[model samples]
Target: MKRRFNSIAPSTLGLALAAALPCLASSTAANAAPAAQNETSAPPADSRRYSARGRGDRRDKWIHRWAPVRNMWEFGIYGGVWFPSKHLELFGPTMSGSGSGNQRLNTVAPDVGLRAAYFPLRFLGVEIEGGVMPTQTRSSDVSATAWALRAHVIGQLGLWSVTPFILAGTGLVGMQSASPPRGIGNDQDVAIHFGAGVKVFINRWVMLRLDVRDVVSNRAGVGEGLTSSPEILLGLSFTLRPKKKKARPRDDDRDGDRIVDKDDFCIDVYGPPPRGCPQVCIDDNDGDGLDNTEDTCIDDPETRNGFEDGDGCPDEVPPELSEIAGIMEGIQFDTDKDNIKSTSKPNIDNAAAVMKKYPSIRVRVVGHTDSQGAYKHNIDLSQRRAASVKRAMVEQGVEDSRIETAGVGPDQPIDTNETADGRAKNRRIEFQILEGAASKTVKKRGKKPPKDELPVEPTPEPKPDPTPEPAADAAKPVDPVAP
Candidate 1:
């Protein structure tokens, strides 16, 4: 059998080995895969339905101005056919053939490759590639196998699911092993390669690739002097990328209610609704829009007439409660809170009693706050405080329809905000009695108060003799008699 094998022509032997390589590589690859991933197993995500969010839209100027981080890595296994061109056969003379020059190495052999690449930029990548192929000479039956380890640089275009790229690289290739077991051949040569490929990302972590390359080597001492060859491969790749963390801006919540403004309906004030706002005060026990921190009558309902109001309470207000704060004196609220205090309940009742006594009075509740924290938060707190006060009166028989509410926060501080006591004084609520057209309906209707109850009007300073008619200008006014 040995003699017969040695007697076979080199051409015949090389052809046989060239054809056997594909089967061997395929079998090896198949056995290397996990048993569960069989031919009939499910495939990966479909490329037809694959897309990244906002992948192809117009991007902002700042995005294009700077480089984006590239964290994706690619690893793949490829198998294909390589055919050396006619000119490549000039590397060495044919062992056996009748011709003026040796024919080119024409054997079509299978090449197997392992590739790993990193993209530092979105459109560019650097790759490390290793491959092995069964090689044959065209002039005779001489045969060998070649292996290579190379470094490549590639450029890609079109940022989408399907991307096309061009590559160029250089490396060392060995044919014939130093030890018989090391490889199929012992000869080594330096070579360069350039190619193009298309990558199809099925998802963020997997892709399919089709690659073609042209390799050049100088092997004049061997079968060919100068060689250039082509390899066409198909491969499946596994992509690696780090998980992205979401970013949130500090000012996302304009009103520090812990709810982001994008979803908050009451962007300026706080309320209760999913993605709307948080409950205002968190102390409105009576549902009368009054918080216990400031409500004088924390036990009653400041319920609205139509419930279609956002001013802390319902529309019904007692007429006699002309000034909301007047009914409850010495009303002091804790800093940053809006709940009505337990100690102020009687004062709240007194205010309610006074309103019931004077049914015609209209009350206005104004909220105040010290300059201890954010101005905006202070404003909201004051408004809530005032609303709670009104709720207290409304619960104690006061009409919800007749009361008016406002919050000035620290804007109208009556005392110095720098001192604790001053701040405390500044934070006190004020109730002002209103007469005449203070009511919205009354002002719109142009009605005057009854004669029996005279409206209090502030004394006005008389004009100072109209500046004595501006003596010089008055002297020129005699033209009125000319007509």
Candidate 2:
């Protein structure tokens, strides 16, 4: 059968090219724009130049900026028109009863393709590309699909964010069709391809690519020549970057210990020479004078109240003693006399109640005098006052032996003696534990008595006991005398 073919269809080719024009134009315009427009708003100073002040070259500036693209793998998909040669050979019948003659494959075929490339260096790479074009023979109603695959070596140059490249490679081309023309069923050929493309990098990972390639293949059957097919393609590509290898540190000292991390036992801790680690020497964690090794209560410092100073524990005192001290705060005496005020009888009774509450702890009635009087007279008066307090406690059901008396006579002032408040504090009575289950002391400081109250006559002073008085008070601060 003789066959005829009109010119190739323009609609398919025009529509595909139209779709790609806007993108191509925009990319080209962007790439062609002046370098200044694409530069950073404030351009980085050229490192090669010295300052106007004639200092030194600014070589280290912008050293930390990251590269947009380097060695990477690219994969892309493209679609465009494949324009085949009009003289493309197809072995088939050209006329009625003819066994072999010239016939043509379809001129215009819509082509789709996939491309993968790897760039080991900045300017060189290798790519493997595969494409499919669906068309038909010009003389018959038979449909056919043509496939071409090629591997190419690419050379490229990076200009700003765009890369323009050229490639050349060779691979296989094949055709599959139903009831193909005579002498031509399924045919395969060795094809050579040369192409040039440009990649517009949108970001570090995504890019737009436009390529045009001339695919040359040997004519099948009786023809001894080759035909060329041109492909115009536009595609989107994604680049994958290889993970960076970490370099070993030459010498690293994180803790500023003067020791390199490799040989240092504790790289993070600043310490001494040998191990480069800290040695915790906690001789006294509680700051109680005694070493932690000998301290029974390492967390709590010792009271050191002259009770049991050897044992490193805070001496536990009865709360009743504090209550008795509070009650004695109301224990006012007649001015400069051992006589107890009659109005202070209630406070004396309350103090006796606290002493009776915990009868196990022994009590001492120690007296203090202000610096107003002669030292010897103050001592004599304070001693008589302490005796009176003891007598009162004894009358309130406290055992006479549990209460002892002493007079410090302004020697140990808890506050400043220069002030009136300090003198009032000095002239106070204290309750100390002479022999008790818990070795602790309590002091009850009295405010000045009201002059309107009557004074009880002083009783005879008790005989001095041979027992020694405590050297000092406990670790706690003395309570101020209440008004």
Candidate 3:
């Protein structure tokens, strides 16, 4: 009988192997085709294949929904220790000397198995396993082997490098005794198992797997009851399917601009800049009629009030300031002294009045002296003269804070100092309008302008014509005479 059983087992094993081999080959080919298809660049025809089905196709939607781990396979072999329950019943008759109730399976045995799993979705998989355990009846000392074939539904949570899973399954468990003094040579029972395990991925294709499970079975015939066998297994698993490659996107420029559409600010309009648009299409941030690239002051609009209009800066010269400059003359000072002459009072008063009319205007009073004196002394005299003019303006209702004073000796002379008339012209007062306009020096004209050029104002009463005679020391004083 043992010989017959051995022969039948080999035949059954051969048949199972033959059936499984073809399936394995077919599955491998099918899985490889997708990988090969993904390996090369997809042709234009192939790219349109999915588009023909429309974007909302259910099959395509379902496949892409679980992109992470879908269509993956894992195959592994494991070895572990199986602890049989004390309630495991024996099939053979017990010896006359031994109590029948005392018969049980061995305490522990080595168990090994092969498992194959398929992941249809990211979080779920189905696995099939087959295992064998060598054991013996403890009381009887009869050698036996146990076999388990299981099918499990696995639920797993996949993280970066680790996956933890729980599984439950039902299958057939068979036990074969070696030369047992029993009625039946073998026993079979239906078994159910549940377990939890973790897989630690060592890399893209290899992983370490561990499991702990409790398998429960119901024995048949007399002395029958439920038996529990617990197992702990550790092994390695390898991915059976190659990863599919992702398609590369095409770089296109819809507007014929050099910039790709993905980076183009204006995808529909063609022109300069990475914006893919015309200069006119861009905003004038300063409202200065110039785009940001052309405007030096992007935030400040060009005044466009005639002066330096093309510079895209604010430089509007107030007309009132120009008028004030025209009248700022004849503010003469005593030779080498900072005292303003009484004769120049009208001009100073006129300037003060104009400044008062335009309260927003500020001016810088600059003094000049002929180069007839020591350079240092001339500079000092010029500064004092400028201050004197500022003081007079302040006394006449103009805010002292609105006026600034500066002195430049004969270095900036507008006329030669060789003659008295030229010297007189050089030692004159000038005004520079400092606010809301470009700075410009205003000198008194040697001759009076036409009535049309003179700004309308309260005319001063005419005075008797009188010119002071030169001081006796002024004819021949220092080698470089002071003006």
Candidate 4:
């Protein structure tokens, strides 16, 4: 059995190595040559600067550092076969029959024992064990079973994944015999043991292990001899909790962008230059004049007058105005017509309500006609139609000044006019606000005549008198007369 086991061990090791080679090769390829070359070539400038700032290995210098794992505790169970090397003796006079020339010698016996160990330190431990095993003897043909308890101090070396350990201890052993049948007896004894083992961490919580130990013990009685035993075991271990890492502190200068709160200068509104503010921080994110930090509607540029504090974005965009051309219901229009059919009234009414709500908002009303008619006539007709819509809005209480009317004669169209639907869409009206009206109020003051209409230019205002000249002129006159 031993020869077979020894022969199989090499095969198993070979298989394991074979299985690991690809991963090992990949890791070596990833980290070996290129990394070494990079390190040699770059010679990190920062590392040199840091070393100059300190003496010796700055890598080990005491800087604020984080440890991912520190203090932890583990628990586990172990099971193994025990073998005893010590000899046990039967304590009786030599077996003899008087004058019969028959004599017998006392016997020496050996037994096997089982054990358990607990490790308080990862590398060292103490073990307590108890077991009973049958013993064999030479001489009187006496047979017995020995029961023993021992305590051992243990030490381990090598990688945590595969550690080897040595142990030593002393304990009391009790024995009972048959065939001269001596009853139970006790003796103080010492034991020495050594073992090698491996541990596999299944996870943070558990580990599995296998180990073997050889034990030796001594005893004295009618006869003395040496005993040797070996044990094999499998075990499982557990940890109470894993260690937690400390967080690293950040180094920041002028951290005013809300990135590092402690180092921030402008905690509320990020400023530019020395404050580390964003480039666009001052411009309204919503284009609403209110900076992004304060604007609730950062995406829209319109303002809400009632709130007065929000960025100019309206609390809500009017649903009617949100559409592409502010037309809903798929309403189609005839060329150059201001007269909306009954079907289109609902969409128009919705837009009208928005205009009424935002009374200060001014809209440009543009009319377009298809290319079927003469361009000039189409332009005239479209202009008339746009004026008609303006009149309608004015009648509907929308301020005339708030609506600018214009006509585009077949210039802008949604699609090719070769198609009927495209031509119909081409003949349409659209509303857009004058660019700056949202920021500045729109007032409908009467139109003043053009500068050309009111005389080519106003008579230049009379130049102001350059100076009070009388005193100078009188002095000059007197001087001239004297000359």
What TM-score goes with each of the models? 0.39, 0.39, 0.39, 0.33
Give the alpha-carbon lDDT of every model: 0.61, 0.66, 0.68, 0.51
By TM-score, the candidates rank as 1, 2, 3, 4
Error of 4 at 327 (Å): 39
lDDT per residue as tens, model 1, 1-483: 988777787879899998777557545534543342242133334311212213342221222222212767889999899876555423433333353344344468788989998887879889998888876654344566667799989898746567888999999866642222222225567889999998877654678889999889874543656677788999988977654432233333434444665555444444334533333323555555544554433455433322222323224444444344343466766646778888888878878788676666655677777765434445567767888888888999889977777666677667786698898777777775543222333211112334567778999987676554566656655666687
Ten contiguous residues with the weakest lDDT in model 4? 61-70
Worst 10 residues of 2 by lDDT: 58-67
Residue pairs in steric clash, candidate 2?
none
Cα deviation of 61, candidate 3, in Å? 30
The CA lDDT at 243 in model 1 is 40
Superposed model 2: Cα runs more than 4 Å off: 1-71, 90-99, 180-184, 220-223, 244-483
Q: Which of 3 and 4 is the better model by TM-score?
A: 3
Between prediction 2 and prediction 3, the one with superior lDDT is: 3
User: Where does model 1 exceed 4 Å of error?
Assistant: 1-69, 85-106, 136-143, 177-185, 219-225, 249-483
Whole-model alpha-carbon lDDT for candidate 4: 0.51
**Which of 2 and 4 is the better model by TM-score?**
2
Cα lDDT tens digits, model 4, 289-362, are 45655544556654432222233445434454455233333444553354655676565666667777766566
